[model samples]
Target: MEKKRYYNDNIGPIKENEVLALKKALELCNEIGDITQITLLIHTKGNTGYLERIFETRNLKDFFRGVKIDQNYPPLKIETVRTFNDDWQGKKIVVAFGLRSNELHKYDDYENVAGIIAHQWSEDSVKDWAQSWGAIDLKTETEIEKTALPDKVVQQAFIDLTNSINMTTGITHPMDEEQCKTYIRALKKYDYELNSKEIFSFLTTELNWESDNANDVIKLIDKVNSGGYFKGGAKTGLQHHIKRWKSK
Candidate 1:
C-alpha cells in the first residue's frame, strides 16, 4: 500500500524568526523544573539536515546523543541532543528531533521528556496529539516568552500555570492493552505481511486513530512480542485471534 503523506510542502531553510522561537522554547524548557527534556518535530529530511547544520554552526551539536533515520511511512530522521546554560548549573536538558508525522507517543520512552517543539508548519493533529499526552506544546509555551516580564518571573509563572493544569506529569500511553490487541488483529486481517510503517498507516487511516495513538499501539505490539509471551512475535502473535474474528 502507498503510504499517506501528512505534509506536502517542502521545508525551506530555517528562518531567523523560527530560530528565535526555537531558542525561546528551549530557554523555557531549560528554566522550568518540570521540563528537562524536549523533542523537536520536523516534517522533512531537508529540514532535519537544516537543523543539523544550524545546531552544528551554533555549537549545539556538542550535546548530541545520536541520530536515527526511519525510511518507513512518514519517513523520519531524529537527532537526540542535550541543551544547557551556565546559569542553570548542574542541569542538562535532552532534546530530540524527528519527523512530525512519526511517533509522538515515543516521546514517553525517554526520561523527563515533558516538552515538545514542533515546526511552525506542523499540522493541528500532531499538536493536539502532543497536548493530549501531557507534553508541553512549545508553540504555546513560547508565546509566554514573548511577554515583557523578566525571564525568571515568566519562567515561574509558566511553571505555576502548567502545574495547575497538570502539564508537567510527562507523556502517557492512553491506549490500553485490549485496544492494542484489537488493532493488531485488524492489521493481521488487513495484511499479515505488512511492515511496521504499513501497520501505522492502517491504524491511522483505516481504524481512524490519531497518529500518536496509532504509534502507541505499535509500541505495545513490539513490547508484547519482545517479551516472548506471544509466539512468532509481531510476525504472527495474534494470528489465531485474527482468524477467529474474520470468521465471525
Candidate 2:
C-alpha cells in the first residue's frame, strides 16, 4: 500500500540516448511554441496491453487527472515509432513523441508535456501522480473527502479511472481513496441501475482488489442498495465499509 514514486530515478537510469531524445523534444517544443516530434526508446515494465488505447487517446487524463497545474505546459501528440526495443531485445516499445499534431485539439488540455512524460514513461511516477490526483489504496478502506471540488471534475475523475481500469496490468497504478469514493458516489447518484458485472468490473479492475476484497465491496454495495440504516443511504455505504474494515 506504499505510494509509488514518480519523477524519481526508479525506471532504471534514463539512458543517455533517452536523455538526448528528451532534450531534443523539449527543444522542438521551445522552437515551435508547441510540441514537436521526437523518437524515444522506452523499456517496457512488462506486458504492453495498454499502449494502443493510450496512443489512441494521446493523453493519460483518462487514467490520471491533475488540478491547478502549470497552464503553459506543452501538449504532446504521440505515436508508436516501433514496437521493438533494441536494447531489451523485443520487450520495449519505440515511441514517437511530438506536439499536438492532430486536427482535433480537445486532448491538448493538460498541464504540460513534461508532466505527462513523468507519468507515461515511468510506472512509479504514474502511481505518485495518481496519489497526487487523490487516488488511495482500496485495501485501507479509508474515507474519501469530497474536497468541495466541482461535480464535473469528480465525474471526469471517475470516467478517467474507469478508462484506466479497462487498460490496467493488475499491478501498476491502483485507485486512491478519493477516486474510490468518487466512483461509488457517482454510482449511487446515477439515474439508472448497475448490474453485478459492472459492479464487479469496478472493484476488480478499477480498484485492483483481489476477488475476496472485491466481494466485500460488493456486499457493502448490496447492503446500501437494500436500504440500510445509514444516514444518507447507499451513498454512505462506502463509509460504513471503511469503518468496519478499519475496526477489523
Candidate 3:
C-alpha cells in the first residue's frame, strides 16, 4: 500500500481495459479466499448495461452495486483510486476503485475510496445465510472512526487478528494519555479525524484499526499479553480493555 495507486473504470462507454481491471481484482479476491459477495457500482446508466457482461467474465457475478457516485457528489470520484489496501473479512482485497480516465482528478494520485466503500459494505447474520461484503478495501483509521461496523469489521478484525498470532511486540506511536483518550473517543464521533492531530495520530499509529496486517496485529496482541503497559498481570488486559471503554 506504500506505493502510489490508481484506478479507472469505464462507467459509460465501457472500456475493455477497465472491465479487465475490475475482473482481475475480483479474481484475485476469490483466489485468496471465498468471495461471499461483491458490490458493483457503475458511474453511469450506460455502464449498468455492462454490469452483467462484466460479471459474466468471472464468478464475481453477484458483488455488483452500480451507482453514479460522480454524478451527484464529485468528491466521491476521488475515491475511485483509493483501493490499494481495502480490508474485508480481515483479508486485504486486490482491487482498485475508480471511475473513467475522463473523470477529473481531485488529488494528485486520485485514490480515495477508503471511507465510501466502508459506508456501502454490510453484513447480515440471518442463520447460516449470514454474509459480509467489501473485503477488498482498506478502511483508514479516520474512516474507521466514521463507520458503525456491522460486526463485519469487528468479526473481520477478530479473524484477521486470529490468523496473525505470532505474538510480537507492538509499539504504539507516542501519544499523550489525553491524545490516546481523544483518539478512542473519536470512535463515537463521526468525522473525528477532521482534527489535524488525528491525521498525525493515524500516520504515527499505522492506519488505526490497530494494524490489520496479520503479523502486525498478532505481534500487537502478543506485546499486550507480555505486559507492554498494563497495570496488573495478564488479567490486566481484560481490565485495560474495560477501563479503556468504560473510561470513555
Q: In every candidate, how many clashes are there?
A: 0, 6, 24
Q: What does candidate 2 score in Cα RMSD to the true structure?
A: 17.4
User: Which portions of model 3 show Cα errors greater than 4 Å?
Assistant: 1-14, 43-205, 209-248
Which residue runs of candidate 2 sit more than 4 Å off their true CA positions?
1-178, 201-208, 229-248
Per-model TM values vs. the true structure = 0.34, 0.22, 0.26
Residue-level lDDT of model 2, residues 177-241, one tens digit each, is 34444445545555224343345444443444444444444554565577652222235445543
Best by TM-score: 1
lDDT of 1 at 166: 22
At residue 151, what lDDT does model 2 achieve? 35
RMSD of each: 16.5, 17.4, 16.6
- Runs in model 1 lying further than 4 Å from the true structure: 1-12, 34-48, 52-98, 120-125, 134-248
Model 1 lDDT per residue over 1-248, tens place: 12111111224444543454346445554355443233344443344554655454543333344332322211122343222222332222333333343444344233343344444343343443343333443434322211122223222322332233322221132323443454444444455432455444443343345455455545755654555233222345445545444454
Q: Evaluate model 2: give its TM-score.
A: 0.22
Judging by lDDT against the true structure, name the best candidate. 1
**Given candidate 3, what's the lDDT at residue 85?**
26
The C-alpha local distance difference test score for the whole of candidate 1 amounts to 0.38
43 Cα displacement, candidate 2 (Å): 44
Q: What local lDDT does model 1 show for residue 16?
A: 48
